[model samples]
Target chain A: MKRIESLTNQWVKETKKLHKKKYRDITNQYILEGEHSVQEALENNGLIDCVITTDDGLLKYKSILSKVSEEQLVVVTDGILKQLSELPTPQEIIAIMKKSEELTGFGEKILVLDHVQDPGNVGTMIRTADAAGFDQVILSEGCVDVYQSKVQRALQGSQFHVSIVTNVALDKWIEQAKMRHILTVATALDDTAMSFKELQLTESIAIIMGNEGQGVSSDVLLHVDKKVYIPMKGQAESLNVAVAAGIVMFHF
Target chain B: MKRIESLTNQWVKETKKLHKKKYRDITNQYILEGEHSVQEALENNGLIDCVITTDDGLLKYKSILSKVSEEQLVVVTDGILKQLSELPTPQEIIAIMKKSEELTGFGEKILVLDHVQDPGNVGTMIRTADAAGFDQVILSEGCVDVYQSKVQRALQGSQFHVSIVTNVALDKWIEQAKMRHILTVATALDDTAMSFKELQLTESIAIIMGNEGQGVSSDVLLHVDKKVYIPMKGQAESLNVAVAAGIVMFHF
Candidate 1:
């Protein structure tokens, strides 16, 4: 393993920029930090570009060092890891992974998040989608970056479990789904919307969730097969987006 | 109309202590900060004890200004509100609300959160439970404070919508529920739990979720009617705690 002490190292600077979504898109790479996160990355070690960490991090995870090939290991300082991480306390190890080749139509169930701005919500949805065996999570163009550290960390390594594709035109998918007889359920607040429990079964479906402040976009809702809602006796207008996604995913 | 500018003001010093759970418990009052939160307390004026804010906060909420009795309104400086807020940009208004007296009776649908430590999770669960038309939320002895700023913010006024009793002895409630023929369903990972969607739900039920890291405590699990699991498909192993809760809640 070679030490990457030079702050001027082009790769170090480039990887650090991945902390920002703009940089991630430009470079097509994202950084995963923390021992647990790095280990999870290696556990699913199919598409990682390289593993970069401090000597101390290497020592800490030495047992799993054999997991990555020598050519893919890069040693750097803890200070460098801090510079690269979006975490308040930088993790000891960070791995650089190539965004999986954009995946589409991977399986029966897909989730479309509509302009959900919260990083934690996005992450939780991705993690839950993976756990519920959803084939893929398709995000509308304006949603939060899935590769952002907060989201990646929240995914709890589920990021690697499912295919996440973004910048989608949801209406086209909804049209296709309807043809396959998969009902597109858009959650709404109105009484006309049937209770979630009463929804008809669709083996193939796309449940669309909207933004934090607003319900699903009107355009997306218009294309859905049916409008549904989680009935509320309490005054809360709705559930958190992630929670809503979870409930819908599990039941669907 | 009086602006209490000095920290020496009796209300200012007393309000500062509301930041801690100890003081909130001892005083039997909790502070609601931010315009939206303060507005929530005001809208539910039956629960508010008093309010403190700058003139702007008072003026901004003029529509609801008459809701709080004039004496309950105590004007303060921005600095006071800042010191009272966990967030940097403290909202102009802050209110002191009396904690609702715990109600008696095991309702038709109850949610038991065991040792859920994240304020966000507790709050979001309360909101989700309310939206799913749950009867109440019971927090085990170790669950996070439901009155914390983040929880309050997450609930988005659902706190007033549902009955939440914290620090309850789980056994006592289990006994009470059993007498009422209420079933307990504990969410777990490895337990050969039936799918959450498949539960033979009794009219009266308790959906129990556990701590973020550890699933339901062994003691709690022992008492549940059945252990239930949300099916997962992707390679990821887990979903966020709140998401898991929503999944179970929606099923019933």
Candidate 2:
């Protein structure tokens, strides 16, 4: 196993760059911190490039570390781990993972995100989609990066359980979905939109959720098979995007 | 209108202390930042103690500002506003509000949070309860403080729309609720639990959600009229607590 003690070491500097989106995009790799995430990655064939841990972590997480190949394990000081982590109180272990290939084919149940920007919301929606048995999740170009640490943390290993497709044009995706006889529904509150409860369960479907402030984009809405709104019986203007997405995803 | 430019002004320091939970608890007041929240507080009779804004904010929110009486408006410099705010890019306007009295009587529908520690989750669940048309939200002692800046931000002014009671003891609350002929349900996955979809719609009910890592407390779970779980069809072990709460809240 390799040992890294200095923050300025070549490998340490390179791994730290994964914290930035530009670096992650360029390298096609991201970092997952904490014992739970590292363990999840190790168990789930998560394309792990390396596992970094402190001596204390190595001992504390012996069972989980046994799964890591000697070549993929790196020992570091607590200071080094702290320097590599974005969290204020750094976890004992971290994993470097390659971004998984996006599955190309449409599935029976799909979730499309249109410009949903909050990291927690994006991550939570992906987790909810997984829990609701959605086949895949597609993110438009404007959504938060799913590989970002906060998003990864919130995902809690659902990233491995669900197929996530990012940077797709929703309009084109909707058209293709409709061509395949997949019902495409976007959440909106326009005059023509029906209550979500009225939506019929379909064999193949794509449910599109929108930005925190804006509903689905007008361009995307125009291409969808239907638009539905979650009826609000109280004085609240709207539900959180992730919450709304969960309600819709679980309904079907 | 009053103008203050000093960062260390006694009032500025005192108001800034509201960022701490102890100070807020002692003062029975909390701070809300940004235009939408302040506007909602103004329109909803939120017991506004005062509104603080920058000169530019006074001009920018003229329509909303008109609702604030001259005696309740105080103008401060950007630096002073920043000093009092927890946000990195502090909004121009802020409102100090007295905590609303906890409603003593139970209502037709309610949401209860038990030891749910994330501020965002706590706030979003409250918002969902409001959107779901639930009567009130009760937070157990261990939940994150709803008056914290992060929680307030996530609430999106739904705090004004929903009645929220904090520092509740769930077991006792459940007992009292049962006595009042209110059905109490909790999310769990033990042998005795049934699918949440099977939950019969009731005239009066309280739905209890638990911590992020743990389901409802065992003691509290013992007191509920029914134990229910959201049946997961996918491989994911669990759903985000807020998302789970949303799905259950809207189901009724």
Candidate 3:
């Protein structure tokens, strides 16, 4: 077994750099923390660059270690693990998994996000979309980077289960979706917008959710096939974007 | 107008103390910040002890100041304002408002939370409950204090518009709700938990949401009339608590 006790080890330096988005983008891999998320990735055949664990972590996650290649495992000192960790209390196990390549195909159901800036919201939406059985989640250029740590935490390993592609042109995708007979729905509150319940079900569909404060962006709103609003019965002006997406995603 | 320049001044000290739950409970008041939340409290006739603003804030919110009593307004230095503020960038205006007294009567639609500890989730749930036009939100003792700053921000001023009562015994409340013929639904994924869609609609309902990591507590689960789970077609283990709450709340 190889043991790394120094923080200045070449692998340690490289793994620490993975905390930043720039480094993550360049390496095409991101640091995944926590036992559950790491285990999910391993089980789902996610690309694993390597696994890092403390001495105690090796024993604690012995079952996890049994599944991975011994050559790919690196045992580190507790101090070294703390330096590589992002959480206040570092989990015993951490994994570096390659970012999944952007998917070209689409399923019957799709979700498009327009400039939704919050990391937690972006992750929750992906998790929700996956639960609702959406085929893919396409992010517009203005959306937050999905590789952000808060996003990965909020996703709770759902990122491995779902197809999440970033930097897509939403207007162009809406046109493509329409051509494929997928009903594109934008959540808006305009007078012409029908209640979400009033919309007729379709075999193929796409839903567009917008920023926290702003509804769907104007240009993207124009390309959608229909506009629907979740009828608000109380004084709240709008629902949280992720919740709104779940309600709409499940409604169909 | 009375002006406070020193952080040690009686009002400044008291306002700063409001950030902690201990002082907030003893004084029966909590700090409300930003234009939206303060304005919501003003419009809804929330119990406002005093309004604190910087000179620029007073000028900017002149329309808001006109509605309150002159005696209740206090002008403070920007430096002092920053000390009293919780955000990275402090809002110009702040208000000290009394917490709403607990409600004795039950409403048609009630949302009960059992040990949902995340402040953001608790706040978002309250906002969603308001949007769904639920009559009230009852928080179990184990839940995070709703007056926490993060919860307040996530709520987006919905706190003033909704009836939110804390420290309630949920098991007892479920019994009362059942007597009123309000359908009691617990969100669980157990074998006996039917699909949320299978439940019959009722005139009134109370839905209990649980902690993020753990679903509804076992003891509380036994008191609910029915248990329903949101059907998941994809691989994600569970939906976010707030998203799950919105789906169940809107399903009715």
lDDT, candidates in the order shown: 0.80, 0.91, 0.89
Runs off by more than 4 Å, candidate 2:
none
Residues A1-252, model 2: lDDT tens digits: 999888889999998899999999999999998988888887789999999999999899899999999999999998889988999998888999999899888988999999999998898899899999997999998999999999999898999988899999877888888899999999998999999999999899999999988878999988888999999988888899999999999999
DockQ-based CAPRI category assigned to the predicted complex of candidate 2: high
Ordered from best to worst DockQ, the candidate numbers read 3, 2, 1
TM-score top scorer: 2
- Could you tell which candidate, 1 or 2, scores higher by DockQ? 2
Give per-residue CA lDDT, model 1, range B94-174, as digits (tens).
Answer: 778889898877778999999999999988888889887897999989888887777887877878777888898887788
Encode model 3's per-residue lDDT on A1-252: one tens digit a residue: 578998889988988888898998898989888888888989988888889898898889999988889888989998889988888898989887888888877768888899999999999999999999987898998899888777888888888888888998888888888898889999998987999999898888888999888879999887888999999899999899999999999987
Best model per lDDT: 2
Backbone clash total, candidate 2: 0
Interface RMSD per candidate: 1.3, 0.7, 0.7
The residue pairs that clash in candidate 2, if any, are none
Worst ten-residue run, lDDT, model 2 chain B? B100-109
DockQ of each: 0.72, 0.87, 0.91
DockQ, 0 to 1 scale, candidate 1: 0.72
Q: B147 in model 2: Cα distance from truth in Å?
A: 1.5
Q: Which candidate leads the pack in DockQ?
A: 3
